[model samples]
Structure formats: C-alpha cells, structure tokens
Target: MSRVTVQLNGRDFTIGCEEGQEAYLRELAGSLDKRVSEISGQVGQIGDLRLLLMASLILVDDLKESDRKIAELEGQAQRLRHENHGAASLQAEARNELTAHLTRLAERMESFADTLEAAGDDSDGDGGVPAPDTSLAEAGA
Candidate 1:
C-alpha cells in the first residue's frame, strides 16, 4: 500500500491505496477537493460534512445527466443506421429497375437493326435501292 497526502476544503489528510493506484486515488481526491472548493465559494464556510455532501450530490447529478445524454445519442445513432439501410435498399431497387429498362431498350434496338439488315439483303447494293431492269433498257434501245 501507498500513502498519499491530499487536501480538501483547506485541510490535509492521508489516504492509502495500492502501489500502482496512488496516482488514480490522488486524481479522485483532487476532483473532490475542486468540487468542495466550488461549494465553499457559493455557500461560505459550511461544515465539512455539509460541504462534502453537497459536492457529492452535484457530482452524482452530473453523472446522471451524462448517462442521459449518452442514451439519447445512442438512440439517434440507431435511428440513423436504420435510415441508412432503408436508403441503400431503395437505391438498389432503383438500379435494378434502370438496368431492366436499359436491357429492354437494347433488345428493341437490336430487333430494328435486324429488320434493316433483312431489307438491305433484298435489294441491290446501292443502299437498298433496286437495280434497273436490263429488259426494260433493251426495249428502250
């Protein structure tokens, strides 16, 4: 065990802790002393017990408030996560719809291209224009 001297409300006292925990104990004492000092400033020179009680109450109130804030923030985080999942689902649905539409459009374009190619095959090579009949030319001659 290690002994540490701490001051609270202008009085010095010795406290004991494990060797490695001396610093942590000192830190806790410092926090208590600071709270007591604040209480003293507000309500001057109250007895030691009353001062310590008021400081402890204040610290407990602060701890409760911090816990409440943490819970509120956690709720917000969960709600945001749910919203993000919904948005991602919606985006995936939209992409699928767009992809299906594009595939149908591509099929229609390919059918049109096949029809044009068949028409071209049925005519002369002059861009689907028929050739002049040789019998008609001979008759004219």
Candidate 2:
C-alpha cells in the first residue's frame, strides 16, 4: 500500500506501487509527463475530459502499433529459429557425407601409392637399394 506523488505536465498526482518501486514508478511517470507535454499542443483547447480522451486515443494508437511490431518480431524470430534448425540438419548431413567421401578418397590414394611403389621396386635394377641420407640431427649438441 505504498503511494508516490508524481508531477505530470505541471500537475501533481499520486500513484500506487510496491513499497520499493517508488523511484521506478516516479521515473516512468516523469517520462510519460514529458511525452504528454510534448503533445499538449495537439490536444487543442477542448475541455479536460476531451483532451484526455484525445491523448488516450493517441497513446492507444501508439500501443496498437507497438503490439503489431511485437507480433511481427515474434514471427520473425520463430521463422529464424525454424530456418536455423533446418540449416543445422542440412549441415550435419553434408558433414557426414563429406567425411565419408574423404575417407574413401584417402583409402583409394593409399592403395594407389602402394601399387606404384611396388611397381617401382620391381623396375629397379639394383633390387630395392636403400637411398643415402646426409642430414644430421643435433638434438643433444
């Protein structure tokens, strides 16, 4: 049962909020007051009720647009999530297929290399003579 005094467009009013939320409510009221003041010129010289109704209409119109935007954003987010799921599935399938293809290629290459080495060994006159190496390792030096 906490109440706070807020001044809106030079008029003082009381608002109720939870005990600890007075400052937040006051700030919200301050912003609303600022907006109301900014739009006062358009309210015309009509009576207070009429002016309030006009302002309320404008606020409601803005809220309607906001609601529409929220719905649009929600739809977009849902669509993005769905597309991401589809893309993830496609990527997983592509990755599996590529992995299988690479494995097969590697095995084929290994087999071909073994066959070529065997053929070269058979063609050598000095049967399978070891090649000389002049490289030196300096691990301990």
Candidate 3:
C-alpha cells in the first residue's frame, strides 16, 4: 500500500491506495480540488461536506456522458464494418466479371493468330499470293 498527501479545499489530507496508484490518487484529488474551488467561488464558502458532495455529483455526470459517447461510437463502428462487408462482395463480383471478359478476348485472339499462321504457310516464298502466269500476254506486247 501507498499513502499520498493531496491538497483539497486548501487542506492537506493523506490518502491510501495500491503501491503503484499513488500518482492516480493524487490526480483524482487534484481534479476534485479544482471542482471544489469552482463550487466555492460560485456558492460562497459552503460547508465542506456540501462542497465535496457537489463535486462528486459533477464527476459522476461527466462519467455518464463519456460512457454514452463511447456507446454511440461503438455503434457507428459496427455499422461501418457491415457496410465494408457488402463492399467487399461487390468488389469480388466485379473481379469475376473482368476475368470472364479477359478469357473470351484471349480465345478470340488465339483463333485469329492461328488463321494468320495458316495463311502464311500456304503463301509462296515471296510472302505474297502467286500472280497469274503472263508469259503469252508479254509475248503479244
């Protein structure tokens, strides 16, 4: 255990906490002192008990508000996760469609290449279609 001296309402008090929690205890006391100061200024030297009670209530209200905000943020995060799942499905579908289109295009290109190769094989060595024999026409000219 550890003991910490903290100032609240202009009075020093010794408080006990776990060994590693002295700093935390002091911090809480500081916050409480700040709240007490604020209330004292407004209410003009109220009793210590009343001042401490008011500060405690204020801190509890703040805690509740924080909890509410946390809950709201968690709900929003869950909704985003759900939306992302749907988006992932849509992306997969798009990928599948693109793959199918590419497959068909590849098949058509292969067929065209085969046809060109066949034509090239049938052509004469000059890489062109054979011209008609013109020997008789040239003799007349």
Q: Which candidate comes out best when scored by TM-score?
A: 1
- So what's the TM-score on candidate 2? 0.66
Give the per-residue lDDT digits (tens) of candidate 2, residues 98-126: 99999999899778656655665566566
Using alpha carbons, what is the TM-score of model 3?
0.75
Error of 1 at 141 (Å): 44
Report the lDDT tens digits of candidate 1 across residue range 1-141: 889998898899998888899788889999999999988999998899999999999999999999999999999999999999999999999999999999999899778655655665677676655544557445542
From the highest lDDT down, the ranking of the candidates is: 1, 3, 2
Cα TM-score per model = 0.81, 0.66, 0.75
For candidate 3, give the lDDT of residue 80: 99
RMSDs, each prediction?
9.4, 6.1, 9.8
The ten-residue window of minimal lDDT in model 1 covers: 132-141
lDDT agreement of model 3 with the native? 0.86
Model 3 spans > 4 angstroms off: 115-141
**Candidate 3 lDDT tens digits, 68-102:** 99999999999999999999999999999999999
Query: Considering summed lDDT, which 10 consecutive residues are worst modelled in model 2?
Result: 132-141
